[model samples]
Target: MMERVHVLVVAAGRGSRAGEGLPKQYRVLAGRPVLARTLEAFVDRDDVAGVATVIHADDRALYDGAAAGLAGRDRLAAPVTGGATRQDSVRAGLDALAARGAEPDDIVLIHDGARPFAMAELVARAIAAAARFGAAVPGCAVFDTVKAVDASGRITGTPDRSGLRAVQTPQSFRFGLIREAHGRAVAEGRHDLTDDAAVAEFAGHAVTVFEGDPANTKITTSSDLQAAELRLQTALLDVRTGQGFDVHSFVEGDHVWLGGVKIPHTRKLSGHSDADVVLHALTDALLATIGDGDIGSHFPPSDMQWKGASSDRFLRHAVERVRARGGVIANINATIVCEAPRIGPHREAMQKRIAEIAGIGPDRVGITAGTSERMGFTGREEGIVAWGLATVRLPVTAD
Candidate 1:
């Protein structure tokens, strides 16, 4: 039989513990939403066939807002409404899958949306064990000593920790088996199971333990969020960077385009097209890093068709070029130099224009003014000068 597995993401928690005023799954970690990063891990893995997230019925706005800007949003299965308890939410998720004609015996991995740090190894191990045992859970052997406490908070007795292990999810299972397990529990009027593994055990199923990453801790408190943020920041640091620089001198024209915006200037860059130096340089740098051809190759200035073209189109074309090569813009730092028409007043507008055209945020694109110290052509007001450095996230390639 063909293997087609789907993940059930339980994100309906109100997160009373974390106290971040947002659901634990929706909390902002670093610059991205917590659950977005969680979903990305599996979505990037080719082994996962599908994904379905469970959320509170009333959190539609929050869910949509967070889901936007994610790398692979189309692959995400429609979210199902969750219930009061975590067990209820899981059952609801199963029902949603059943309505879609999912097979009972098919593989399904149930994961906590709060545990964004769950590594690919843990996922692989759980899937491996589940395929063999019908059910598999992730855990680490209990390391510290344990004690049984009384109502007065005094140690009533000491318990052995040698045989105990703390389990984590995504707990993998045969979909048909887990659905039946939940149905049986509801019929039995019992609903207090801690995790999916416990539910399977109650249904006479054996769940094997696979070693899990210690970093895969649930986000229950502020400290947990802080730790997750730190891990995510470290991951973001390895992001790729690309650089570009372009210069254009004064030509007899009515207007000049800077960063995709037309500005009133006595002289425009001398080119066959509306030579926007800022956009041209940024585009050249972006394409340069991806090994894509320069603007001359894509839209040659020698061609009359590009004459008087809006610089916005040039920027958009450049952005599409980068995305086509599976890379993303990290940051853009561009400098504009000229003796006339101060660039300070237009800095914010230029940055906004660049960000919009580049498909990035205003924060990711920056603009600075440069003077030739009244010594060079720019200082003499004979021409204008512009340069840009574009940093992009280019996927690693095997040489």
Candidate 2:
């Protein structure tokens, strides 16, 4: 049977070391509070049964605002007000969960609120380990040379860093074991602690460690924050941001046209097809969304099959490929981003055209316009460049 999960996130740190005006957990990183990232890491996982956050009483406003924009925000259990020391605060959190009727044997992940970079797979690993071994935590191999230094700043013998390790949060446990461990630690007057491992060890329970992501570093000192920023940036680079530029230079021919239909212009566009850039880019984007080949692969440039063919036909064909695989357009937000003819007046018409070609609702088709302040080829009015995002949802069964 699957263990009922009640992940307890501890976010009451005052963050005196970072020296920010607000608590470190509430501080904004990558447009959301640090704690929001941690909560989302839990909410995104299908195995996480529930979540309980322990925060400073005064931080309710910050918490609410930060958690607003994330999907599945309702999964967060009600806030528990924390106590003086870290251990006291943890006891208060556990009590709050018990007050909320969390079962004794359910697993609880006691994660540091400041560590926001834990990935979904890491969370799953902790849960699986907890189920098998009774407790687990993500840890990285120690890199620096360990040493036992004296109070007088004299060097002691250098110790081996190979066997040493640095532990990170999302520490997993059998709920009853952790609660009992904390209670015993309090009774024994053992208060010098920084992590749940110490408490569990004192209670005579065996704990296991697994390989952790190097990116999962706790945000404490200013240098740590910088390191976190670098990791976050690295992760975000996977979004595959691309600025696509396509321009059909004016050629000696008939009246000019763009976006499938004819628009009054001085000269016609020269391309293998009707040269509707908006539609072509949208077709390519649909292909990109599915991780298939590009637009050129589906319709080669040299093929007379598409010569002078309406660009709408190309987009419609791409839509069919997605539909054949049981995929539908979730949303398509695009920008014309040019300085040629005014796109504002034709924006709605463009949306209508794209909706028909994409086989999606007009509401799902979005368009925005911007000029480059006369900086590049687009600013010089040489051509129009467009950028867009197409989000697709994978097929899934209801639980």
Candidate 3:
């Protein structure tokens, strides 16, 4: 049987040095909270069995605000309240997992909530190293010279940098070993152990070292946060704009759906589903931005399951697709072409509904209405048409 991999993120620190009113983990980074991005890094991975966080006792509200929309993820466990020190916080997290029946052979990774840039490669290496060595820590080799100073700040000894390494987390260990190590530390009143690896080493365990990624830097100050934001912005420089147009004929009905809103009309639009032209066009536009197939390909007209289905489902699925790719919908501009129903009265409601479905702000959704100037099929009042343009920002990839 495979050993399950679980992640424990330590986020209970007050982080007063970050210079933000909120804790460093809760601070906004690239339009998302630092803790949210950190949690997603683990939750989105298929190899990770589960993820739990240790939060400050008073920061429950802050943690919730940062972890908005992630609480529903299947792999995310309820957060545990931390004690006074970092060691205490990790212990609390481990205890929570044990209470949930974690096996002794399972692997647990102790990660810093401030480090959000640990790539999948690093995670795989950590898991492999822990499985092979029982207790493993990641570290990067130091290049600069090192010195030991006395209390008065005088250099006492010059150390060789070639033998030095700066350690990093996701320090991985067998669940039972680390739990027993932490328990021993608690019994011995050794609360000053800085990290999980130290706890293991203090308990006479031989800890192995694995390579750590330099990009997985911790956010300790305002400057680090700024650099991380800039890095993320640079990585998401692939901006794309997609256009989609949809038309549906008028049929015999008293109401029509547009942009997920039901409006009273003399004739409703005819399609397999509630023919929401605006939402359909917007969905296609979003899918186009990601190069995914069109609405018909995803939800085919031949599929009876989607018969009379609400178009909001389509738009919501598109939004989730974008999110899955780490893409952001910058804005959605859609033009509604119709002669009847006076779209002007329902424009605000339409924008709000579309925004709600797209998981963006109403201000980011632009709704424009126009007539076909009595020339085309829309001009003949036979059908309603919608054209949508979606702007998206995605991380640049080799593909």
Specify the highest-TM-score model's number: 3
Query: What would the per-residue lDDT of candidate 3 be over residues 1-399, giving only the tens digit for each residue?
Result: 667999999999999999858889887776667887788778877788899999999998777655644423678888999999999999999999999878889999999999988888999999999899999999999988888999999999998888788999899999999999999999999999999989999999999989999899999999999999999888899999988889999989999999888999889999999999999999999999999989999999999999999998888778778878888778898999988878989989998777766655567889999898887888899999999999998998895
Ranked by TM-score, top first? 3, 1, 2
User: Candidate 1 overall Cα lDDT vs. reference?
Assistant: 0.78
lDDT of 2 at 287: 69
Please give each candidate's TM-score: 0.68, 0.60, 0.78
CA lDDT of every candidate: 0.78, 0.73, 0.88
Model 1: pairs clashing at backbone N, Cα or C within 3 Å: 104-176, 242-390, 242-391, 242-392
Winner on TM-score between 1 and 2 is: 1
TM-score winner between 1 and 3, please give it: 3
Where is model 3 more than 4 Å wrong at Cα?
57-72, 244-282, 301-316, 323-326, 332-389, 397-399
On residues 281-349, what C-alpha lDDT tens digit does candidate 1 reach at each position? 887777776777788889887788898787667666777666555555678878888877678878899
Error of 3 at 270 (Å): 9.6
Q: Considering lDDT, which of the candidate structures 1 and 3 is the better prediction for this target?
A: 3
TM-score of 1: 0.68
lDDT of 2 by residue, 329-357 (tens): 56666667556677777777877667656
Worst 10 residues of 2 by lDDT: 236-245
